[model samples]
Target: MKSLSLHFISIGGSVMHNLAIALQQQGHKVTGSDDEIYEPSRTRLQKQGLLPAEMGWNPANIHTGLDAVILGMHARKDNPELLKAQELGLAVYSYPEFIYEQSKHKQRVVIAGSHGKTTITSILLHVLNYHKRNFDYLVGAQIEGFDTMVKLTADAPLLIAEGDEYGASPLDTRPKFLFFQPHIALISGIAWDHVNIYPTYDSYVHQFELLADSLPKAGAIVFDDTDDMLDVIALKEREDVTRQPYDVHSYRISNGQTWLKTKSAGDVPVQIFGEHNMKNIAGALAVCDRLGITEEMFYEAIQSFKGAARRLELVTSNDQKTIYRDFAHAPSKVGATTAAVRQQFPNRKLIACVELHTFSSLNKNFLGQYRDKLDQADVAVVFYSPHTLEMKRMEPISPQEIITAFDRPDLQIFTDTASLQTFLESQSTAAPSVYLLMSSGTFGGLDVNRLGEQ
Candidate 1:
């Protein structure tokens, strides 16, 4: 592969920055601009010598010499840099489009869904890496053994990617996964999310249907059969394409430890628990089977898989108590995680706290979706910031609306972090318990380490 000259717009984004670094490491000339770059992305770019000297877009950064300009979803369609690229007739591609351009020659496997995509992709990557297979990947989170989230190599014959249903970029309104054109795809499950983009539930589900229809002759789609919507999609008439369905893997929890039951292997002890994870394992196994990995190999490799970052991650643990932090803000994720934790520790009291941070979770119209989602927890708490609503230009929501939406009269709601913390401290006086802090954002900058202290 010859070195290519490429520029990125809105390079500070989580995946955008990682893609830029991946290309640079592949011996490509990479330049990018963004108005604001946060931690991790900022430091990572700096270490790679790719950080823009000045923040904000400058049309001067655009040049005819560039082979292609990759646009991130964070950038606006009217961005000056994007306009300049268009004026110059330079090829502009969304990050997803660019990823497809690079991996067009390789066999593609895309893991997609409203939830569990990251975990399923991470599992596939971990198993492939364990067998020393030569493959490239683009995962959403930072895994333990993988240094970067995106990797594109010239010689690798396989490319594993996590497909998101969100808009591809400001220039493209189509879902990101539509661009991958996977020879093999996995839809973990479908639950309505990103209400701001797909206002109607049917519209949100249509994206996955498009993916299923895009499969080529002899292509395969691995899906969760338990999901009614996914089951309907799989039933679509596609005689040429194979539909592989999977359910939750069998497992048993003993003395607070979850063990996976394998037919070949007597029992496989895994670090991660939860029925959702078991379902993730089943889906991953289905995909791996198509990739030529045996069930025995999968069990051996998966036993050591801790889990993707922020998915039921253990923050701190002791003989009597445990605290876990999860990136679960969506209704389906919140419910599944709450139930998983409660089931794992039936003898211990469970205190589950969730922060409403995403556009979907904060939307009044979408609030009803969360009804009974946290009912499994022994004590449930909800928190939201009014300042966030102001920033999003959304109408302020009252605590009563939330109470009515969740239909949990005993639910504790907090608008202030201090009060939430105080309430949390109050619960500590009770018997030995498990604490689950669920959110995609910080609980108003609450210190997890401090809260975890016994």
Candidate 2:
């Protein structure tokens, strides 16, 4: 990989900024522009001397001497810089396409699904890092030891990427995973999400089918057999690729601690627990096995894996209660996360609160998918901000509508954050209980660390 000048259209993006930093660290001359830049990305780029002097697109940044111009999903197809690049006949590559260009020689392992992709990818990376293996990766969430979510190196033989099903860029409507062309892939589970793009269920499932079908000859696809959709995909006759099915790993819950049962290592203790996570572990182990990591080595590395940030992350704990914050906005994720907490502490009263924030979760058409998702919690509460709906230009929903959608007459719904926080704080004083706050948003600026102290 020779040093080359590269410019990013929307460098303020989360992954885009990280990629810019990675490229800069690799001795590439990196420059970028974004209409708006937010915290972390802004401060990070400033430190790396990659931050744009001013916001908004500038065609002057484009030059014939540049190697290529990478486009971020945040930038529109008609962006001025993009138009300039096309006018100059410069090579314009979407971030995914550029990533592939850099790692075309490496064996790619992509973890794809509606849920569990982040967890499964994080687990694999943690295990690989634990054994001191040199590998590059692109994960969605921040891991404990990793500095950046995206990493690329010239010499790493493997690239473990979290394959998102969302559209790659404005110019490319295909799912991001399609660009990876993985040698080894894993489908955690398929549940329809991102309603704005994949309007129909069939369309959503088709993206994953394409990924499965895209594998190279003798490639491997590890999937969860428990998912009906994944089951159908895996059953398809394909001699070119290997279909490896995995189920929930053998594990037991003892006094609120989950332990993995292994033949080589007696009952290994792990930091992360949940039925969904057990399945995630099984999928990761299957992929690791393909990567030449033995079961013994995986279990040894998994014991210290705390899990990806915001996926059932522990906020605080005391003598009689524990509080967890999770990024579980989708229907399947909400159900799995709530059930996992319930199963983890069956004896304790579980109070679960979920915020409807994502476009899919707030839409009335998609609300029915959440029916029975929070049933496992002793008290299920839902929070939604009217301002959020207004911002998204979605129809305002009533409490009755949510009640009907979830089919839970006892469900508590709040349209304001203060009221929601009040209810959660009141319940925090109860002894022998667990609190799970699930959301992709900030619950309208409600502070979890303060709420956990109540």
Candidate 2 residue-wise lDDT, 71-144, digit = tens: 98888989999999999999988878899999999999999999999999999999999999999999988899
Task: Output the worst ten-in-a-row residue range by lDDT, candidate 2.
Answer: 423-432
Could you give me the TM-score of model 1 versus the true structure? 0.98
Clashing pairs in 1: none
Question: Which regions in candidate 2 have their CA more than 4 angstroms from the true location?
Answer: none
Residue 31, model 2, lDDT:
96
lDDT tens digits by residue: candidate 1, 317-382: 886678999999999999999999999999888999999999999999999999999999889999
- Considering summed lDDT, which 10 consecutive residues are worst modelled in model 1? 422-431
